[model samples]
Target: MAAAAGPATLPAVVEELLSEMAAAVRDGAPISDEHLLSLKFVFGSSAIQALDLADRQSITLISSPSGRCIYQVLGSSGKTYMCLASCHYCSCPAFAFSVLQTGDNLLCKHLLAVYLSQAMRTCQQLSVSDKQLTDMLLIERTQEA
Candidate 1:
């Protein structure tokens, strides 16, 4: 008899879905509705909220000429959160509590928003100099301190 298989890991499932969206973008084709549905099915309410945030144009991609990129999301509470998609980091309380501290969720809604915005090509893009990017980061850190 064959052994039963367990459920797919969250990271693996997310990576696979994102890879499909990325491939669609690379091929100059629109992401299929099925793909978005899959995201909703996997991520649940967070996916819907993320889609709403992305549709509202609340996510910004700030990139420097040197190839560093960061995401800024205007949350529903009118607060801004910085997100690093590459590292799966979001400067949000929910991220700290739910994602990191409790480990109840794989990602916060803000990070999901960033990912959804990027995949849908809906994010507002800003290009800044490397020095400006550094200054922005410094200012943000100073404010947090």
Candidate 2:
């Protein structure tokens, strides 16, 4: 019988595959079936939905003049949450549990969406005032209606 992969193996494999996919996309090459299958298997259904939303321009990423990469994801609930790519963090519960606490590198949908958007070179920007940033953070914690 074949031995199972070690803990570090999976992340490394996923990283390599994602990099290959990104490179193929940048080169305008048709992505291979193996790459697509690897992506689907690694990221699962939620990430696919996030990618679709990103393709539809539902995810908005903001880049400050200071070189900060912040993202805003509009969820199906009609609410927006922030994503910090530099920190590998998001203002959503899925990120908290799936990425942070569990230490899973897979990341939340918002993060995945931002990644796909950046890889495809279709990321957009939105201007948010400092006050809005504060409000957004507050709302993320409280989830106010």
Candidate 3:
């Protein structure tokens, strides 16, 4: 007799779905309504939450002179984390454990907040020089550690 199979992990499921969607797009195949709905269902909740955080002004972006994307996100615990938008990196446990470990390019709430803000052009980013950015990052890293 064949052995029973367990459920696919969340990351595996998401990765497969995305890969299929990308292939379909590349092949010029029309994505059905069901496919769109499935994608929406997978990301809807987190997207809404991220938008809410952005609306609440919890996400502040700092424009880097070197063109690196940086954001300061005020989390639910009133703690701030540095989010690197381009890299989908965050100075938070969720990024370290979930995203980095799983090799999933998933954004945490903080990174999502920054992403939405940038996409909407609503984030008033503070422009900083390279030296200033480096100094600020150094200070923040030291404080967090």
| Model 1 TM-score, 2 decimals | 0.80
| Per-prediction tally of clashes | 0, 0, 0
* Order by lDDT, highest first: 1, 2, 3
Residues 73-98, model 2: lDDT tens digits: 88656767788776567787788787
Best by TM-score: 1
Q: Determine which window of 10 residues in candidate 2 has minimal summed lDDT.
A: 5-14
Cα RMSD to the true fold for all candidates:
6.6, 6.8, 9.5
- CA lDDT of each candidate? 0.87, 0.72, 0.68
For model 3, name the residue pairs that clash: none
Q: What is residue 35's positional error in candidate 2, in angstroms?
A: 1.7
Badly placed stretches (over 4 Å) of model 1 are: 1-10, 22-34
Q: Look at candidate 2 and tell me the lDDT of residue 135.
A: 65
The number of clashing residue pairs in model 1 is 0
Candidate 1 on 18-95: residue-level lDDT in tens?
A: 878978987899879998899888877888888899889999999999999899999988889899887788888899
